[model samples]
Target: MSFYNMVQSEKPATLLEIWEAISTAFTHNQNEQFQITDPRHGDFTVHIEQYADFSVMNNIYQPRQETLHIPIRPQVPSLLMSFCLSGKPGLSGDRWEASYEANQALFNVFPARNSTYVLPANTQHEDLVIKLEMHTPFLEEFTSDSDDQLSNLLYKATIHEESLHSLQGNLTIDQTASEILAGIQKCPYTGKLREVYMESQVKLLLVHQLSVVHRLQHSNKPDTTAKLTKADQEKLQELKLYLESHFLEDHSLQSLTKQFGLNLFKLKYGFKTLFNTSVMKFIDDKKLQYAHLLLQQENVTVFQVADTLHYGHYNNFSAAYKRKFGYSPQLLRKG
Candidate 1:
């Protein structure tokens, strides 16, 4: 079957094993039936559940009914982005519900808990799912100081209804999704050019998302840091080496300046001149580069990398990871 068509007819023999493979590939969670690598940048796994007709028993004594998981919830905090390829999906919670027809999309942001969904008996659902985990930097940038901030941010993380209106561009839905999907597919996109492109696309997505949230009204202005001198570029290379060795630790401007014996202002200015990003952004970028390398290993945990990098917590790390890389740390773990 095409990679995109991989499906679970029934639950896998061992849910954990299946989850492991999915985790290795997609690094995110979903309701049991479907899993996928993000196609946005072409980066994760693809899991699906296709039903010509299906059902389940309810209340311990309803009837052998044809339904998908009648009442299901996602196990992770994700912004579920889906594009309806065909058929219709009936979604309900107590009294409020809606049907999403083919050619439309349903962006559902599921918090830490599940949405009590009742899929209609006759409904057939099909779509491309992009599972999102919040980035640590994003969370830290806006949340570190208070619980109320985190709560408000989390509740509002979902893509707003207005933003989901058909993307207005020359690219078709498949084209846009495929472009992002391709980026995701390029695992370990190394080299300076590749890294720049990867990071750039991610930043674009973030800016796009912020615009959706109305927090960012315009796209980011171009970066205009000065050109780096050859000497500074060499120093930056050394600095990156240091970051690689100490990927799990917190780094600061003063510490780096002292270690390199360079003036603090000069170091900061040179870093921007050379990298076209702030020193902290460069540090975060290197951390992300290392995290991508770690993701190649089968046993690394998302939290481990967070702790190694001195992230206060996994969620914090995740937010930063997403902001810097345009994807989630959890997705890497899934792969």
Candidate 2:
């Protein structure tokens, strides 16, 4: 095994230097999973599976000394989506650095990319990375007739080296997306069948994330009417992330305003203006949508799911679910 020790203050090593240290340094047994405990590499069991369409890398590691440098070929013309299933790992890219904190889903596309993830000390980290490589024709067909940021990402990366924040999209792993992600982890197929299942599921997950970016892109355009500055709008975006992470908790408008440092009017009105949904409604929808996923399981009853969601009354949860979905909560199980 090979190991390189370096302090954090030094300049980041180039990708080639990193590869010499880690990627081919150790010989792994031909199993679905293997161990990499080469001191500086940390102690981790990794499952790196490559299928016909895309690839998945599942790493469960505990922090040791020295930051981890992962080196490999750049999967270009692809959307790389990463999830921190557990632990709060700190990640910094050689180039495209956005919010790489744990519990956040960050995805972006480029012709080539490099990243280094520093798993926090004393924490158990489980991260799943999904790379959806695309062909020229497939991406071309998908982005045609659209001038959205996604299309802009494809066009910009083709000619330039700079990365934009919007294109380096960061998001919360909401209920539905989480479900899709779970499906990927528990995929049952093997061989070519496994490839097809993974490809389809990853595509679905990408579409789900794209829909979110598309909505937020349009909803957050300068109100032209409100006195909100660009900074205020950015804060509102941050506020949305906060709400998504804590939507199940009981939070009053006053408390939320204080937490986000927005006044009563902007907390209510600006949320409405920027997100196109009231704060309370936004929270309620997230709750009910999560409830929908839980109810789909035959083992869990509606009341049990509602209680887990902190719903004070079963009737209120059911009514809200019915209102949003146009059917009673019981119908999902029956169907």
List TM-score per model, in order: 0.32, 0.55
**Candidate 1 on 1-335: residue-level lDDT in tens?**
22224443332223234234333333223223334322221112234321111111111101113432334444445444544444554444443455554434444454444333333333344445444454445333443444553334444554231222222211112223435544643536555665465445544443333333332123373222224343554676577567667745667889998887667766776665434457787677777788778777787777777777777778888898888778897776665
- Positional deviation of 217 in candidate 2, in angstroms? 3.7
Tell me the spans in candidate 2 whose CA falls farther than 4 Å from its real position. 1-32, 37-41, 71-78, 88-99, 110-117, 134-138, 145-169, 221-335
Q: By summed lDDT, which 10 consecutive residues of candidate 2 come out lowest?
A: 22-31
What stretches of model 1 exceed 4 Å from their correct place?
A: 1-65, 116-124, 134-178, 181-335
List, residue by residue over 111-194, the lDDT tens digit for candidate 2.
444554455566677878775555645345445655667665544543353332253445555556777888899999898888
Q: Candidate 1 overall Cα lDDT vs. reference?
A: 0.46
**C-alpha positional error of residue 54 in candidate 1 after TM-score superposition, expressed in Å:** 29
